[model samples]
Structures are given as C-alpha cells and as structure tokens.
Target: MPWLARSRPLFPAALLTASWWGKVLEGGRAAPRNGRCVMAPVRAVVRLRRRVCLQRKRRVLGPPAGPEAAVAAGAPGPGGGSPGQPRFFTFDDPAALPARTPRKRRRRSRVVLYPDGARRCRPRAERRSSRAQRCLLLLVAIVGFQVLNAIENLDDNAQRYDLDGLEKALQRAVFGQPAAVARIVALLRDYLATHVHSRPLLLALLGPSGVGKSHVGRLLAGHFGAVLEDRSLVLQYHAGHHCPEARAVQLCGDELERSVADVVARAEAEEKTPLVLLDQVELMPGALLDRVLGLLQPQRPHPFQNAIYVLLSGAGGAEVTRFVLQNVTRAAPGETQDEAHAGPRAHQTDMELRAGLRALLAGAHPLWQAAAIVPFLLLDRHSVVSCFQEEMAGEGFFPEQARAERLAAQLSYYRVAGHEFAVTGCKQVVAKVNLL
Candidate 1:
C-alpha cells in the first residue's frame, strides 16, 4: 500500500479534484509498483481516477437532482444521443428517473353585465312609451291609407253615388218605372264626367213641377264647384246686401244693381264656376232665357266661357206662356192680346227662343253640348220607396223599408194615367210603379 501510495501523486489532478481528492487518491493506491517503475500501470490508474472524479464532480456541482437535471445530464454526449455514455459514467446510472408531465390549465368563467334590471323588466313608463309609439305609427298608416283611397275613388269610373234619395223625391215627376232611374243616374254621371271641360251658356233642365230637376242641378253645381244663385238671391245681391234676404225688394236701386254686378264680376275674376239654378225659370221673361241661351252657346276659343253653367229648371210648355206674357204685357193689354192671335206671333216667339238658345249655343263649343243639356225623366212609385230607404239609413228617425213602401204607395196615387214625370231633368227615373 505504501508503494501504491507513492504512485497516488501520479493520478490526474482533474480526478482528484472532481471525485474528492482523498477518495480519488485512496482508489489509486491499488495500482502495483515494481522495482523497475512500470509507468504503464500507474498511468492507467491515473486515467481511471481522473474519469471517476470528473463524473462525481459534475453530479455534485451541476443542476439539482430532479427530472430536468437527469434529462440535461443524460443528454447526448459530445457527438449526439446515440448508444451509450462515456465508460466512466458506468459507475453512476440515473436513467431510471421519471419525466415531468405538462400541467393542466384552469378556465375562468365569464360574467354577465346587466346595469338596470328594473328597466329590463316591463316597467309602466316603458310600456306606455312603446304603446304610444305603436299608436302613432298606426294613426300615420291609417291617414296615408285614407288619402290613397280617396284619390283612387276619385279616379274610378265604375263607382256610383247614392241615387235612392233623389228617386224618392222625384217619384211623382218621372214618367217611368223606378228601375229606369238607375239608367238616368248613369247617363248623368257620364255626361258630367265628359263635360268637365265645358263652360256654361244655354244649359236648360226641362221637366214638370216636383221633378228633381232643381235638386239635380244643385248637385251638378256642387260637382262643378260652382257658386249658385236664384232670381231672389240675385236681387238681394243687387240690393247691396252681402247676405241672402228672406224677401224681395219692390224698387230696383242702381247702386244695388252695381253691387250685384260687382259680385258677378268678382265671381268671374276669382275663376269660380257660376251657376244659376232657376227653379221657377218660366217666371223669367223669354228675353232673359234667350240671353241665357246665347250665353250658354259654346263659343270657339272664347275666354271665360267655362266660367258659367246656366241652369234653367222649368216645367215643359212654361216657356211659351212666359214668352207671350213678357211681350204682351209690355204693350197695352188689348193690343198685346190681339197680336198674340196673329200667326206671326207664334213664329216670332219660336224665333226668339231659338235665337236665345242659338246665341248661347254659339258661345259653347261641341265640347260643352254633352254637359250643357241634361233632359231627365221623373221617378216612379218603386223609386220613391228606394229613395226613402236610403235617406232612412242616416237619421234614425224612420224605418227604411217601411218608409220606402209608404212613399211608393203615395207616389203611385199621384201619377195620372199610370205615368209619372221625373222631378229633375238631370237624372233618369229608375223606379216604375206597376199599379196592377
């Protein structure tokens, strides 16, 4: 051992320092020493000691003794991860160490944010606001729908107005059955629609008393957007009165006439439709009708020709009486009566009326003819009932069916020889009474 100890100093300094110098030195002493100083054996012992010390030192001073450390230590040698480690590493094998498994990540839950739960709930104020908005939208929709409907109705040609009321009023005046009244209405509507572009000149409504001629004329005026006036009304306007009067004036004032003229002038200037519905037109002098006829005549390219719709409502043959009285009354009663017997008298009267009508027609163009003349037949018994029923639909004052039957019966009684005249020459009689 002493001899081997002497060779301990020959061991590598790396082995001695890495493996703990004392332990490395002690292990080296096992080497044999010969009298001849065998350097080969000593060198071999030194090499082994140096390798052991290096490994021991690396294990002690390197990373901690964990899986990571083992992996780092067991990593590929100087070349790479192949078969084995250095021969010196055979003494220390830590390859049995377990590997580290990856850690599982925890998930965080999400939080929902609701600022005001009360508002989210159906609060009274919110509900009220929503309801109000809905109602406003509904109202707007309704108004828009109504406007569109009105425009469409105005454009429709197939649409018809309620004529039952008119028929009842004219049941006595019409000359035919109630059913004929429908045809009259259709004709009247067609005429008005076609003649909207014409002016008033010699327009006349020839029918008997109680016929709806005056009434229909008024309605036509309304349709034309006309301002209407009668003889009395005209006289009132001439009396310097701005409003209608209940009575007529005995004396005609020039100033009042001028005022009436002003009104007419203003009506003309304001671009309004002027229509005079003379109910008792026969009362007026023949000269007046003649003048009216002259005005009614369609004028070619005449300015303000469309501004008037002369509405003369009179009983048939009434014009003849007025014509005679008007001219005869102007002369001495005896002289006028004597002239009335002359053949020239009837010729003159006919010429005069024709002249007036001709003058009016002259002013009116062909376009005005359709609208200017509306000769209507009166309603019959059944028409009277139908008209009454229509009127009853509104005012809850009467039973529609019963009232219509009663009116029809009364109208039937009034017709002579089973024939009735239309009240208004404007519309035809649709209802007829079969007395049998």
Candidate 2:
C-alpha cells in the first residue's frame, strides 16, 4: 500500500488504466502495508511498456532504409549529419558515377649534342664569352682588310713629281722635240684643269719608232706618281704581240678583260686618272680597234672618262716627217729669224700637221677623228749633239766640258746627216753613250 501510495502520484492518470499499470498496482497491494519497499518490479514493468510502444510505432511507420528515410525520421546520417544536413545519393555500382580522368605526367627534355659529339650544356656565362670572342675576331679581320686596302691604294711617289719637275724631266730626258714638249705640257695642263668633265683627253702620238712616243708616256706616268715598270696605273698594250688577236679567247681569254676592268675601277675609286697607252695601234685588228674607240664615245658607258689614252702609231710616220720638214720655217725675205720667232707660221704649221695626220689616220681608221694628232719631230744634227752631251754628263762619262763637246760632235757627225736625221731619235744615242 505504501509503495502504491509513492508510485500512484508519479504515474499519469491515462497510463494507470493500461494492463502494465494494473499489474504494477496489484504488485503494490501484495507488499507489506507498513513496508516502504518492492518498487523495483514497478520500474521494470514501466520500462517494458515503453519498449512495446516503440516497437508498435516502428511497425506502423517502417524503419529508415535510405537517405530520405533518415531525413524524414530526423536521424543523423554519415559525417556528423545535423538538422540541416546535406544528403548525398549513394550508387549501388560505382560505375554509375561520373568517371574521373587521370592527370597527365610531365616528360623530361633530352640533352642536345655538339658537333664534336659533346653534350651542349654550356653555362650562360661561358656561352656569352664565346659569342663575344667570335664578334671580336670578325671585327679585327674587317679592320685589317680595310687597312691593307688603303695602304695598297696610297701612291708614295705621286707627290715627288710636280708640274715644274715634269717639264724639267721632259726637257732633259726627251731631246730635239721642242714643239712636241710644249704641246704635251699644254695638253697635260688642259687635262688637269678640265678632267672633271665626261670626255677623256685623247692624244695620238704619230711618228717613226724610238721617237720618244713611249718615252713621253713613261714620263707622264712618273710625273703623276704611277708605276711605269709594273703597269699598275699605266696600261701598255702592244697590238702585234701583246694583244695577239681580236677575239677574247685568243687574247689571254676572259682574264684580260677582268684585269683591265679591275685596273680602271681601282683608279676611278682612288679619284685618279688612268693612262692607257696603245703601242703599234695600226697593227691591231679592226674589231678590237672599234671596241677601244667605243669607250671614248660620249653616250657610251665606259670607265675611261677620267683616263688619258695615247695611241702610238708608226703607220704614217714618213708622211708626218715629210710634212714637218717642209713646213719647218716660213720666214719672209727680210726676216732671217729662226722658226721660233715665226709665231703665226709655227701655229699654221701645227694646224697643217694635225690636219694631215688626222686625214691619214681617218683614212685607215675612223677612231682617229676623236684624237689630237701630235707629231714627234725628227732630231737635227745640233739637237742630236746636245742630247749626247746631256746623257754623257748625267752618266759621269766625259766629265771635262771640252772633251765631252768633242766626243758629242764626233758622234753627231757619224750618226746624223744634213737632210736625213736620226730615225731612232735619242734611243741609239743613249745606247752608244752607255757603251762608251
């Protein structure tokens, strides 16, 4: 009764009407009336009734089987599911899920090889140093090449011969041709003054052999600081042997043309005029003569605009000499002066000589029309004597003036005649003096 009195107040009036409540009340009546014991059976009976109620509720609503069931029952899912937990759908076969592509692995680069079969893994500093060295070598080579070219082009002897020196040499070296010397000096002056023009100064030296035609060319080259012996700036071509044929193949082939062009181009680059001496020009082939003439034409493209071309021809030497001798003097009856005093007469004679020579050359070849014909006069007995004395004096032969004069007179008497002068001019005289 005491246990019932303690338990009856704690149980709800609704649960007291249940069978387990009725059993708990019957057990309470069997206990001692005065004892405050036997409440353990009542507590067990209440726990069994609560478990039975939970089983009945599970049967009615069904246990949670999926994510939806878990969410609806408010039960915690995987990974700490709370009230607002995000539910993940589970696939039975993992293949049903979207596939994840595997990542690509990076490949290592291969080493490069050098020309000597060595690996090319040079450091940055070493590579830069090698590049700088190559550049330096190239620069040094370029500078050396330029310096050599400049040195080769410079003419050391050019400044040694002046206009005055040129005139003195012409007078001393070339004898018995006063008119020729004057004309040459004048022509050179004119050429130097007007060389900037397009046309070249063309001279036709017409006379017999050994008449200083080639000698004059040599003197001019020497005066201008050109190499006379080596034929660098002075191009000498003897038609008969040197230029054997008109055809390029027969005349040393293509090499000859290249050499000529190279010389002219070099002279032009140096701002100097080149001298082209054509010896025995009359003997050259007509085709070759025409080609040479074409270079002087105003409309043609040629490297000889700044050049001085001397055509030495013995073709009409006799005719030239006959003309000079006939017109040597044109004095009046009262005038006993020499040919030097007859200024007007001398001018007229020169004009006639040039006209005659021009006519003769024009008859043989048309190229002579562009040239100024200059006659190298034949040396007289007096001029021959003076030439012999000058040459002997220079050579240290016949040092005494009186002895030299006597030897010169004897030589002139033996070698020269009254009407016919020395054909070889001073050439044979020099050779004889050398023998003495």
Candidate 3:
C-alpha cells in the first residue's frame, strides 16, 4: 500500500473508496447504481480512469499494450521500479533487447596489389588512358631532339670552304701560264674529292727559290679551298729541343697532334674531307714522309676520307743533290761521266726529288699504273707579259716603264742569257725574260 501510495495519486484512490461506500449505502437504489442513479458518478470515474490507462499504455508500448503497456497501467514490478522500464544494455544476453546494431561503416575504396604483382589502383581503362598521355609526351620530346640535331648538321654542312677565294687568286696569279695552271688544277681536283676512295697525291716542284714554289703551293691550297700549314712550323714545334728522328715519338705528347687528330676526326665524322697544304715539307723526317706517303698510296683510302688533300711543297734542290751523290762516282781518272760535274749534280737533284715520290708509288703499282707522270716546268709568254704589264708594272713593284723601252731592254737581256744557257723553247723565253 505504501509502495502504491508512492506509485499512484492519492486522490484517485480516495475517490475509488468513496464510490465503494456509496455503492453499499445505496442498495435500495442498486438499479440506479448500474445506470442513471446514485452510483452513476462513481462508475463514470472508473470508466474515465480505464480510458486514461488504456491511452497511456498505447502511448508507452505500441498500440496493443505489451509489458511496457502494463507498466504504464501502474502494474507493480518485482525489482520495485515500473515494469518493462529500460536498464543497462548487455551484449552477452542475446535475448536482451536486440542489441541496437551499430550502423555498418561504409566500405572504403583502396588500392590493392593483385596476385600477379601489378598495382590495381584505378580501373584498367583509366590506367591505360593516363599512361598513353605520358608516352606520347616522351615520343614528342625524342622526335623534337632528332629534328633539331638534323637542322644543326645541315647548317654545319653549309659552312664555306673558301673555294671561290682560291680560284680567283689562282686565276690572277697564273693568268698566262695556262698549261702549268691546268696541270695543277687537275691535281687539285683529284686531291680535293670529298670521298674516301680517292687518295692524296704528291707535288714535287723542283726549282730555284725565286721560281715561285711558294706561289704554287699557295695557289694549289687556295684552289682546293684547303688550309695552308707551314711544314717548318710543325717541324719546329714537334722537334722542340729534341732531334728530328726522336721527334716522331714526341708528336703524341704534343697538344698539336691531338688538335690535328680532332680536326681530322671531325671531318671524317661529318663526311667532309679536309685538304692540308704543308709547305717546306722536305725538312720533315722520313717517318713523317712514310705516313704521308701511305696516304698518297693508291691502295689506301684518303686520310680523313672526305675532301682531303695533302700537298707537300719544298726545295727539291737538296733532294736532287743527295740522289746524284749516292748514284754517281767520281769520273774514272777524269774520264767523262754522263753528266760531268754540273750534269751529274743536276741529274742527281732530279733523281732525289723523284725517289721520295717513287717511294710513295712502290707498293701501290696497280693504282699508279694508269696515272700519268707529266713533268711541267714553264711560264707561258702571255702570262709573263700580263704579269709585267699588270702586276709588276702598275704596282711599281718594278720600275714603271714605256712599252717599247721595256720591250727593247727585255729583248737585249734575253739574247745575252739565252746565249749563256743556249736553251730554246720556253727556256729561251724565260732566260730572255730573266735577263730583263
């Protein structure tokens, strides 16, 4: 009852008891207790409470009053609290109000390694799509670089070799000497072929110093559009403080050799042959001669294998002297020799100059068999007159002179020198000219 007092309102209980007492006292009006009489109010209060409890039960439990409905209707619980009230949640009891299942966490998308060892991140289509873009960029870069390289190569090829300058200079220098000029130009043409098959050639210009050996070298190099290198300078540089024979080994030690090798290598790589004009080549040693001779040999391909030519120019006088000394003995007790004194000496000079050149052709007879060895040594009359009139006359490198006066003076001297040498043809012409 004490517990009921705490649970239910006191007024409802008091009203109930009062209604019960009225029911007993109004027995005479018992029929009215059932309806419109003295117990009607009490019955009304009971019906109202029943409706209230039913409504509360419906609200607490769902529509058809469950255990929660009984609690709302004031049913007493064994634990002393309202029946069906919630307590602590226990996962250990399966029947305990179905453990409110934790909402499932959304599955996270992740990168995974496949059994085949490939990375499976994006879909196959997406992966291939991106990879193709990168590959295209790389291919573009490679193609661009190759194109740039080709353009640079073409530019380098266009660089001038100065052939025009050489041609003009030679034309001016040898105006009247057409025959000599033609031979030289032909040799230059052979020397300057920019192919590997054509070999280099030797030019042994034998004459006194004032006879224009230097001019010939310059003209040849100029004609071929080649670089003119002073052989003496190379010799001095390589010889250093050492001997000539010993100098060969030290060539590798000098930066000059490396520089030359680099130039030759670059020429070969570019498929352009380079011609080298080495003046005063006689001063160079036999070993160096052998190397150059090898290049001139027909069987071997041109050195640097491009448009390369090496023209060797020097005083052949010394070479001639050596040849004569080696071959000829003193005339037998003053008996006549083929070339007594000056004859043997001159013959020897020719032989020496020829020997060095012959040495170049020795083993390569097959290649040289068909080639002509035309010996040319003359300045034509027209070229001489042209030089005297244009270059020597105008420049005043010689005294200015009237045409007839110059002619008479020149004719007088010519007759004198011609009588001394007694040589005819161009020799007579040169002797006459020299006297002038």
In candidate 2, position 195 carries an lDDT of 30
Worst 10 residues of 2 by lDDT: 411-420
lDDT tens readout by residue for model 3, 1-436? 3433453434576567667668779884443334455455545555556656666655555432234544556554434653344433334533443433335679988965477866547667766758788999999999999999876755444333344465566666644223334455565554443244454444445432333455656655544344423222111222223334545544624533444455556566655555455455445555554554454555643443343333333344444334433443433333222124234354444344455645554443322222333222222233344445554444444634464235423421212212211111122333434445
Give the candidate number with the greatest lDDT: 2
Candidate 2 wrong stretches, greater than 4 Å: 1-161, 226-231, 244-256, 328-344, 399-420
Candidates 2 and 3 compared: the better one by TM-score is 2
Could you tell me which 10 consecutive residues in candidate 3 have the lowest summed lDDT? Answer: 416-425
- TM-score per candidate, chains pooled: 0.33, 0.54, 0.36
Q: How many backbone clashes does candidate 1 have?
A: 50
On TM-score, the leading prediction is 2
Per-residue CA lDDT of candidate 2, range 269-370, in tens?
766667777788877767677777766778744565777888888777888667645644453433321234335666677677777888877877788889
Task: Looking at model 1, report the run of 10 residues with the lowest lDDT sum.
Answer: 235-244
In model 3, the clashing pairs are 176-383, 194-307, 273-306, 273-307, 274-308, 275-309, 320-348, 320-349, 324-348, 414-432
Clash pairs, candidate 2, are none
